[model samples]
Target: MQLKGIHHVSSLTADARRNVDFYTNVLGMRLVKKTVNQDDTSVYHLFYGDERGNPGTEVTFFEIPMAASNKRGTNSITKVSLRVPGDSALEYWKQRFEEHSVQHGDIQKQAGRLVLPFEDPEGHRMQFVSDEHDQGVEPGTPWEHSNASPANGATGLGPVRLTVKTAEPTAAVLKDIMGFSEIQSYPHPNDTDLPDIRVFETGKGGSGAEIHIETRSDLPAERQGRGAVHHVAFRVEDADELQQWIERIKNARLPNSGFVERYYFQSLYFREPNGILFELATDGPGFEGDEPFEHLGESLALPPFLEPSRSEIEARLKPID
Candidate 1:
């Protein structure tokens, strides 16, 4: 059983209302699911994606009110990349970011593709990469009601960049356990003298299915906070495939949370050698399972297990809109 690609990246947010505003109104992604973290039902778990909240398209957040700012350093999921239509779309977003007063840098090339780096108000690192040359896992359709034009809207997740004190251990885990292939490397953006960032790809290898690992010995381990990524999950076909992955992780002797029922999808979570949390998640029974397509993210959603406590849960969360 091979992994598909990125399923979702869950990050932290202190302000659920502002987070929803930025991702939906600014980035133009659809707020596909308004849910609570299953493990801790006290906070919001917001999911933004393309039209349908497909496997490779989601970017989620867990609300942690008044959390401190993230301490930037190594051993972290440093940067997240979102895929836009093409080169011209990068230009479109550049202008849009300016109009919205979003902090961003000039468009540049990364791994031979055009990318425009930016940050949310809370300082979460992110970039928009042009999918002009992508050939692998297909991207999701942009939301029809997005504030940004569909042609220029973000489509799906691209390569996630991880910064660590050393890359070999993490690289080994990715290659040996996750069935990823080391395709190529590119010079680190900040220093050519440092180790080159390595690119790894999985099923259908493309922007949507790759991981970029950067070695950063000079920095300390990250102190996670409101702006830090919680974990990155890769795509599994279904419960059957996820079960196989659970066995694989167990066979490898890695500690993991096996077979989590997330309602929208099933998952297994484990940390790699570098301490970066990784998850293998099933793709189906998606966001549409609970809410109607048109009214997604309009109300709070909890898994069947949590439904009994919906009123209590709802009372704790502040309205995001």
Candidate 2:
């Protein structure tokens, strides 16, 4: 069955503040909420995205203040990419990056679209595309939060982009069983200079849109570790559709790890041959479960299992402010 689009991309990092600054300052994502990790309240859970912190457009992080240096493993995504409105958005980002003094990779076209690649302060690689389409959200910059209006900031979860270590089985599963059709292909969108990169866009290409899988076959496979993507989640209409996908994954004999609860949603994790962690997640009982939409990401939220320990949990969390 075909899935909607990426639900969210979650990763681990050693330093929380640096991660926050890089995403907000360099990338222009709004730090919607600052809270503690639900699984480990001692750590921090940072959510960054378009204004109002909508789903689909979110890039989430679990901060391990003292995490060891990461190895870019095959299973973990090396870069998290975002698709902007088009080439015109580049000038805005160019000035923003220069303002922050963040080191950046030259503009290169990948997956049939122009993309500006840059790295977070903690060395997490990220890119934004110039697709010239409705990105469906606005993004806020840390340097100009007070200046951001309701209209200019990212509105919700948009597309989550990814790069794969290989294209064989991963691309195969997506095409064969996952029902993802390869829309089209072209030279890298950012530059006509580099070798062509295969771009796979899934879904209708809407907000919380599908990923653009790129490969630098010349580069080595990444090692999965902290500051690296844990998994790229795709969304379903609800739990029922998710169960259907579980059966589909089983039917295909793909290596699936059954289901795991993420408090707000249930998930099934698996790996496509190329080594990227893939997750099937439900959209129900979403970010609004623990708190009102207006108050989300503003506090530490625990699942039912941890509800009884709220007091202890709250005591262990560091103040976000």
Candidate 3:
């Protein structure tokens, strides 16, 4: 069984409303789902994605006030890169970030593609990669209320970068279990002295299909905090395929979450030897399962099992604008 591409990248957020404002108003993604973390019903799980909440377009967050103050380091997802229409789109984003006073770096060439590095208010690293090769053709639908114009909106997610003490073990897991190919290598874009980063790809291999591993042998392990990524999920076809992955991981003696029904999708989680959390998720039974496409994220949603406690959960949660 092969993975399609990244399903979503889930990170930590301290404030639900601020997170909503930044992604929806600033970056121009739609709020696709308003739900709670299934495992811990106390925290809110917010999903941001393209118009229909497509798999590759999602970047979600778990709002946990207590764990909101963590640090970044090795053994973590250092950057969540998004694919924009072209160089002109990158220029548009550059102007937007400047106007909004968001922390960002000047446009530079990374792997022969234009990239603009930036961070969210909570310090989670993010970047926009230009689709210079015309690899991504998915038309991004800008949220009607967003500040960004529809013409220059972000298309979808691009190469995701993960930092680790070494890339061998993680690379092996990617190639063997995740159906990724060792594509090529490039010098660390930020630091010339560090080891060259190894790139991998899944599915048909373009744009959102890539994963870059930075072998930062010198840096210590990362600390989990507000800006830290909780896990990176890959897209599988459906529940049957997800079950196949569970069996594969079991046969390989890899530790994994057997089967988790998150209402929107079924998920199975596991960690590589280097400690980066990886999830195998199905693409069907999407965000529209509970709420209509036009009304998504407009109100809180609780899974069937949790519906009984909806009142209590609603009373406890702080309203997000």
TM-score of each: 0.99, 0.81, 0.96
RMSD of each: 0.7, 3.9, 1.4
Give the poorly placed runs of model 3, Cα more than 4 Å off. Answer: 136-140
Q: How many residue pairs clash in each candidate?
A: 0, 33, 2
In angstroms, how far off is 223's CA in candidate 2?
2.8
lDDT of each: 0.93, 0.64, 0.86
Q: Which residue pairs of candidate 3 clash?
A: 68-226, 70-225
The TM-score measured for candidate 2 stands at: 0.81
At residue 122, give the lDDT of candidate 2: 67
In candidate 2, position 162 carries an lDDT of 54
Candidate 3 lDDT tens digits, 1-321: 888888889999988889999888888888889999888888899988878778888899999886647666799998998888788888889999999999999999887789999999999899999887845324345556656776677667888999999789999999987779997898887788989999899886776878899987777789899998899999899999999999998887788889998878999999998889999889888888789888999999888999999999988888886
Q: 277, model 2: CA deviation in Å?
A: 1.0
Name the lDDT value of residue 280 in candidate 2.
85
Off by over 4 Å in 2: 24-28, 32-41, 73-75, 106-108, 134-152, 155-165, 187-195, 206-208, 215-220
Candidates 1 and 2 compared by TM-score, better number: 1
Where model 1 places Cα greater than 4 Å from the true spot, the runs are none
Cα lDDT for residue 138, candidate 2: 34
Query: Which 10 consecutive residues of model 3 have the lowest summed lDDT?
Result: 134-143
